[model samples]
Each structure stands twice: as C-alpha cells, then as structure tokens.
Target: MPGAHGGSQLPLFSLTIMESVLDAIHARYAPVDARVAEILENIRRDCRALERESRNQGNERQVEEFIDRLRAEFGERVVIERQRLSAWAVRTTRWNYLFTVRGDSTDRIVLVAHYDTWRGPGADDNTTGEEIVKQYLLADLRAARRPALTHTYFLAGSEECGLVGLSSQLLLALGLQAANLALTQQNWLWAVVAAALAPLAGYRFGVSGSREYVKTLSTEQLRRIRGVVSVDSVGEGRLYIPRGTLGADFLHALIPFGDYDSINDLLEEAAHLHGIKYNNYLAGGTTDHVSFLEVNNGLWVRGREAARRVAARLARRPYTPPLRVPATALVAMLPGKASPLVFGGKIHTPRDTPDRVYPGPLRETLLILDYFFHRLDGGARVGEPRNLDEFHYARLYRTAAGHLLALKDAVEPNRRNVNGVYRATATVEGKRGIATVRDLVGWGVETRLRDQVAEICAQLGLTWERERIDELEVIGDDARLHFARHLTPFQRLAKASHRAIAAVQSVVRNWIFLTFFALAWVLAQVFGWALDVAFSLSTPFALWVAEHTVLTLIAVVAVEIAILLYMMARRIPTWIDNAYRHENRADNLGSLRRVRDQTLR
Candidate 1:
C-alpha cells in the first residue's frame, strides 16, 4: 500500500522503457506464463511448507524437502551443490541450490535468499524471500526474449547458523568461478542478492548474511562481484533505505531496510548521465558488506596484547591498532525505515507463523525488486525511487566534486589530482615509486578509487594506513581521504639521522679552523711552562728568560697547529662518509615518495 501509490518517477524516456517491460512481464503467454497470482500462490505455499517443516529436529528432512520442491517445480533448471562446512558451522552442512536462466550475455545477477529458521515456523523470516526468487525464476523462464544479464537464483542452507551456507557455499563457489573465468574473461561482473527477515514493527533490515558472504572472498574473487542487493525485513510500518558497510564494487542496493534501492537507482541514473560523484557516508552497522571489507582490506582489530606482541615482533612497536576497512569497495544500498528494529515481534518465536505475515508489504517489496531486475535487464522506465524529493543531489554532487579536487592540494608536493582522484608518483635515480589517494568513505563516483589506491600504494612501496587520515569539511562536503604517507619507520629514522648528520657536519667543518687556533693557544702556554722549567732566572736574567720564552712559544705554537690540522684532516673524510650515508638514505626516501606519486598519477 505504501509503495503502490509511490510510483518511481524516473525520467520520461526511462519510464517509458520501464512500463513496456512491466507490461510484457504481466502479459499472458502459452503454457501458463508469469502472473501475479502465481507469485502470491507460491508465497502462500512456501509459507505453509515452512510452517510445517521440522527444521529444529536436526533430522535435516526440511532441507531435502525444500530441495525436492525446487526440483519438482523447476525440473532440470534446479542444480544443487553440496558444500562442506568449516568448524565454524558446528558440523552442519550446507546445500547450495541454484536455478539459472540464460540471457543475451554471460554476466549474471545472482539473487539469493536463505532457508534456515531459528526456532519456530519462520514465515516472514524468509518465506517471502523464497517466494520472490521463485517468481523471478519463473518470469525469466517464461519471457519470450532473453534479458540483458543472466539470472541465477541461489537458495542457501545453514544461513540461520552463522552464515555458513552463504560464506562457504555460495560466495566460495562464486569466487572460484570468478577465479577460473579470470584466465579468459577479465570483465566478468556478477551480483549477489538476498533478503533479510521482515514483519516486526521496527525490524525491517537484516544484512549480516550478505555482509559475511563477501568478506570470505579473496581479492580476485571480490573483483567479480559488481553489485549486491539485500532485501531485509519489508512490508513494515514505514519504508526507508539501508545505510552501512555493503560489499560490492558497483550497484549495491538494499530493499526496505530504509529502502536503499531507491537511492541506489537515483545515484546510478545520475552517475550514468553525469560523471561520478563523491561524498562520505557512515560505515555504521554490520552487514554482508563488512565481510567483503575484511577479506579485501584486512579490517579487524587484534586484542591489545596480541597487537602489542605482533608490533614488537615486526618493529619493536607494540600497539596493535584496530584496522579500518576502506569504504571504497562498499557500494551500499541503504533503503528502508529509519527504525532499527528489523524483526517483527514474532520473529524466531513460536508466533512467527503465516498469519503474522502480511501480503501488502510483501507485494510492495515484490514490485520494487521486480522493477529493479527489469531495469537491470533493460526494462521500461517507471518512476524514480521513493524519497528523492527530500535530499539535494546536485549540491551533494558539486561538494563532492570540489572535495575530490581538493585532495590533490591537501596531500601536496608528491600528489596530484587525476581522473577525479589523487595520485602520488615520482622516480629518483632510476628507482620508481607510486601511490593513489581517494575518498575514504567512498559514497559515489569513486567507489573503487580507495581500494585501487590501496593496491597502488602496496605496489609502489608506500606505507598504508588502515583508517582515514582526518575528517574535516572539504568544499562543504565531508570529504575524507585514505590516510597514506610514503615513509616507513625506517625512513623516518633515516630522515632524522640525516638532519643530525647535517648539523654535525656544519659544526665540524667550521670548527676545523677553530681547532687549529685553540691548539696554538694551548702550545703557547706549554712553551711558557717549558721556558720556566729549562731556565731558572734571577732578577738580572729575567729579561733574557722572557726573550727566550717568547721565541720558544712561537716555535712550539707553529708545530702544535700543524699536528692538530693533520689529525682533524684525517677525521674529516670519515665524518663526511657518515654524513653522506645518512644523506643518501634521506634523499632516497624523498625520491621514492616522489617517484611513487609520479608513477601513479
């Protein structure tokens, strides 16, 4: 009822295209084409089955039943793969069920949802999610023309048990697949989709599953995931968008958490039309995206003692700081109500039955996802996503752009702005170096920039920081850059030593002449003592003694001056050598930083 009247007011051209696609999906076809009734019926049947399934008994009969139902419903289109779990799953196994519908291209949009329940008949917990996947699969199959991207429906098991099904079963397989494809196809992009439980008054977003799934992937595997959509608890009191750490490079959308899909759609349209935009958003909560950041960015904090021990081993420094995951890789979709309550009052309880679930919210979620997929498949344009009227997109874009440009100035000397990001490159005496800098929060336009910046820094031998450098308003935008400085501890030490050496050299070089004068003065006094010891003078012979003392003093002073000059001369070369060594280290560091910056830019 909420989204029904809230039509997506897209641009006229896109709206026309969207309507055309929607019409086609609703059109009747031979051998029973896709219909809204089918979706509603499937939802009801799944909810009934879920209510009856005995998942808590641990016999795993429900898993088999669900698998059988899928096979019977889709025939050969259903493919089940057994996934062995780690110790984390507590010996529970996972079965990844996939239903694929080929399209005009090999690029896939994997829509996934879990089937495990906590304690009771989990209807709104996930029955809605299962039904949605079924609807999409059927619609894809019945379509006369193939869509732009391939559609894969993955119903994962063991999700209720610490995300073992999603992490080990689905993400691992996808990563392996992407790795294999990398040898031949470098541009392969895939998206994983999932929905969190809904129906609680305040609870309408659950993204932990999707977040953890992406975290388990290696970098190569992560590169293949271009997008991720999480459909958390929906059909609640107020529709809003999700906001937090989402693991994907592009096209991250979440439905009904706070209704982030609408925001995602608007950003995409704007990005596609205009160039990229940049800004900062909170990496506030946990979701499947957090896992992606973990795998890619190594974002975890060790215990203080453990970190101390590690730092001691590495550099005698013992502060194991919490590692901050770069926000660049998280193209998050934060859409849903602002309320934090994701599960309705009955979730995981005995009362979480079919009666608790409502068709109104379910239908609204179904339409949103339906229109989204069709849009991805080049569908008829409808209206824009909900809640765009409140925010100022143009101002945000302008501020972000200005902030991006200002990063070059802020990082100064070795860094320069390039392609809407900052790059540091330089070369000294044939040795090259490089690094890149981008927005730390990675809101838009520069989603992948920060991660890429990390990669270049690693390649160019620059020290990388795990957190943002600083947070200050830049050009009226909360522009933050990934904190990276080209100096390591060794380099910093070398720089200090170089300064000390230079100071010592200046003093020694000036003191060389002063040393001769001081030695002559000392020799004059020594000659006077010699004169007193060699000649005992009476009252009449005092003048003679004085004359002899003067002559002896001059001779001794000349000899002492010569000797001191020789000694100081011998030591000057060694002092010069030490100075040169320290200077070389300092110069090399500066050169390396410059070279790195130059190469990257």
Candidate 2:
C-alpha cells in the first residue's frame, strides 16, 4: 500500500536494483482489465504507423499531416482549430486539435501534448507524446460504450517554440468559459499533459509546461480542477512518479523516488515483451502539469466575499461574512520520466533525427496511459485525494490554543514588556513547523506568526510569493509528503472566516466613530456662534481648533485613539471568553462520538 496512491512512507530511493525489481514485476504482471490490454494494443499499432511516417520535414507540414491522419482515423471525435498569436505587431497562427468522447458524467479528463518540435524530427521530444494521446483518444472513440468520465484530447502546436500554442489554447478556453459564465459548474476531473515520453536511457520527470498552464487559470477554473497528470519521457523502460509538487525538482533533492501503485499496477498488468524500469527522485524542472499546481486557489472565494460585502452594505445588514471554501484541492499527478539525459540533449539540436526515436518507449508509455484512463473511468482520485476526516474536521485545537497562549504571554498587564517595549521577539513550533515572530507584541505576535508561516511556504515552494497563503497552502500537498494522510483545510476556512469578520467590524466601527465626531463638531460650531452673539467673548482659539487643518487632525487622532482604546477595553473580556470556549470545543471535537453527544446536549 506504500505506493498504492502514488506515495511511500519509506524515504525515496534511486537504486538501480529497486528500479529493476519494479520493472520486472511490471513486465510479468497481467492486466486485470481486458479493455486496458485492448487499448494498449491499439496504441501500439498507431505508434508504429506514426513512427513510419516520421521525417525531418517542415514543422507545419508534419503537424498538418499528423492532424489529418488523426481526423481520418477518429472521425467525428476529432476537431481541429487554428489560433493566432501576436507580438510587436508580428502575427503567427498555430493549430490545435481536440478529440472528445462524451460520457454520462459531466466531469472531464483532458489529455494534452504538443505536435511541433524545436528542431529536427523531434521524435522523442513530442512525437511519442502526440501519438500516445491520440491512441488513447482513438481507443475511447472505438469503445463499445461510453466511459463514466469524458475524455478530451488537446494536441497543441508550437510547443517546442515556447509553449505558444498551448498558451493560446488555454487563453481561448478561459475566454469561452468566462463568456458562458460556467465558473460554478464542475468541468475538469483532471488534465494529463504529455511530452517527451519516448526517451532512451535515463528519464527525467518534468511538468513545467503544465505548471505554466495552471498559472494562467482563474481561481474559479482552478476550483473545478481535481488534479493534473503529466505523462512525459517514458521510453527508458522504467516508470517514475516524482514528488507531485516539485515535478522535476524532486530529482535534485537527493530523495528516493517511487511510482503510483495504481499506475504501476496497470503497467505491470499490461507489460508485453518490454519491462518498465523507473525510480522516483527529487529534482526541479518545469512541465505542463505545473500549471495544475499553480492554479489560483482562492480568487473566486475572495470575489464572492467582495460581492457579499457590497450586498450587505446595500441591505444594511451585519457585515459578518462566510469564510472562503475552495471547490477543489491541489492535487497533481506526475507520471515518470522525460527524455533521458542522452535523448533530451539531442531534442533542440539537429541530432534529433528520426533514427534517435524508437517504438519500445512509445509502447510502454501508451500502456501506462491506458491504465490511467481506465482507473479514472472507474472513479479513483489521484495525487493527494482527500478522505472523510479531512473534509469534515481538523486537529487544530492544539495549534490555535498554543498560538493564543503565546500572544497572551507576549504582553504584560500594562500592554508592555519588562523592557518597557510593547513588542517582543518570540517563536512557536507546531505540527507544521517552527515559526519566529521578531519584534512583536500580543496582536503583532499573531500577525508575525502568520507571516513567518507564509515565508516558510515560499521556501518550500508552496506559494507563488512569501506573503499569500492560498487555499492549497499545506504540507501534505508537497510532492514529497503527499502521503501524510491529514490536511487542515477546515481549520484554514475557519480562520479566514474569522479574519473577514474582524476586518468588516473594524471598518464599520471606524466609520461610526468618524460620523459621531463630525456631528459633535457641527453642534460645537452652532453653540460657538450662539455664545459669540450672546456674550462678547474672544473665542478665536475655539474657532481655530475647528478651522485650522493641523488642529483638526490632532483632534481627530485624539478621538480615534480614545475610540480604539474604549473598544479594546469593551472587547477584551469577550475575546477571552470566546477563545476559551472555542478551545474547549476543539478538544471535544477530536472524538466523533463526543462531537455527536455535544451536539445533542
């Protein structure tokens, strides 16, 4: 079970022997699903046919021929479209081909690959990926019945030139989705992006292209997405699943690498004359699936909050708003291998000739994808799939209470430290890790701890920046530790709710204070005028305090501080009471029966 869901409790290993054992198991195994074997055979035939047509010809002509052949083979399942790109007034167009198989479910799994090469015949770089994706598409089309999940093939052009074609295609999709206002509906089950899956010798797993694509998606689009699987460079007779988040970087971390057991199961079952060899490791690089991991996790939630705030203001309702809850979790499945060092080195060079390509890797790659498709159709979630405990609750009572205690200890009764300073330097360690708050007071300690956690997230490559902790911010999502089994999504949601409520209260309270000050000033002016007429008094100072800008600013500051102090004095007891109550509830919620009993009571 260590590798069942695509992770292991044992440390990552790169030993050749381990790779050999796994490969041997795969080669001897027989597929449990008859359809998987049938589809693999179809993939083999298509790959062979495609290989025979390879030549160091024009890129456009090659792409066109490939598209034509696919359309002819798959019939109505195939659709081809062209998109234009412009830079500095220079324009260029690339073709995008799609093959769709509709199913009973609205959830769709999209497979992507590029058809163009950087130079030469680009056999290993993408030809293999293209054919593999096409084969899967054709197999699904030829099936006697529809699978439970929809499968879409997206064959993009100009990928070798800098992913231009894929970029255009994604933007076009988003534009269409926005125009149709389909953000609320579930659309993507996951996306599998393939490139360089036929490399010889040692293979590297890369998902940089996928990451780029994910980075472009809006938060709403991201929410519907479950995961991204990258099928790249499978030719080395070995299967590898890099740490999902790091993609290629997992190789560089000197950590052991392993494959998803489900994928491995299919590979083992489908192996023919060739054996699959692979070792998961740590290294960093980019691939198309990286886009899946880079999706904006909380943008939609924030937009909804903004909308609620506007509605609340119009309705004159209390500003307390619901917390953000993302529709999907961050899960990326990176299948093993890109071109081995030897094969990849020739990719962009003229040496990338037809002779460098082979059929063995292509065949193995197809089998792996075939099994993956079957599993998806059977309803298995990949890459950090959540369970009931994760969805319903979190063990954050200790963490939260500890944080509160730290805040309480950071301040003296007078709100200053022994050094007569309101701020202190402190640190706290938790289930996640250690965090340091430098030069912080009671309230500042809370802020500093949050900031430090965010900083740690950046160092671990969990966030785009060091300050923003989006919905997917968690240790378990890390490509290395995806098997940790517990996540704190609910705890984060609760914190976000509390933060939002506090922010609204602050704004409304400030507005109220300013309104009262303005009213008092107006009344003072009227009284001053009445006194001026009733008694001959030199009240220039009183008038100047109202008229002079500096005097007015000083008066406002004094009033604001007084208001803030009064509010804090009034709220401190309430805050303490709530904190204790929540801590008690958290402790009680840890046990399922206790939670139910408490509810009943």
**Alpha-carbon error at 424 in model 2, in Å?**
51
Q: Runs in model 2 with CA error above 4 Å? A: 1-60, 69-75, 78-82, 85-93, 161-222, 244-276, 282-284, 297-345, 358-360, 379-601
Compared with the true structure, what per-residue lDDT tens digits does model 2 show for residues 441-465?
2121112233333333344444322
**Per-residue C-alpha lDDT of model 1 across residues 62-170, encoded as one tens digit per residue:** 5567567767776765445444333433322244445667667665566666555565655555555666666666666666776687676655444453333334334
In Å, residue 224's CA in model 2 sits off its true spot by: 4.0
Model 1 / residue 243 / CA error / Å = 1.6
Q: Which regions of candidate 1 deviate over 4 angstroms? A: 1-44, 50-53, 56-79, 90-93, 161-221, 246-295, 300-344, 378-601
Candidate 1 TM-score to native: 0.40
Lowest lDDT block of 10, candidate 1: 389-398
**CA shift of 513, model 1, Å:** 66
Worst window of 10 by summed lDDT in candidate 2 = 592-601
Clashes of each: 72, 49
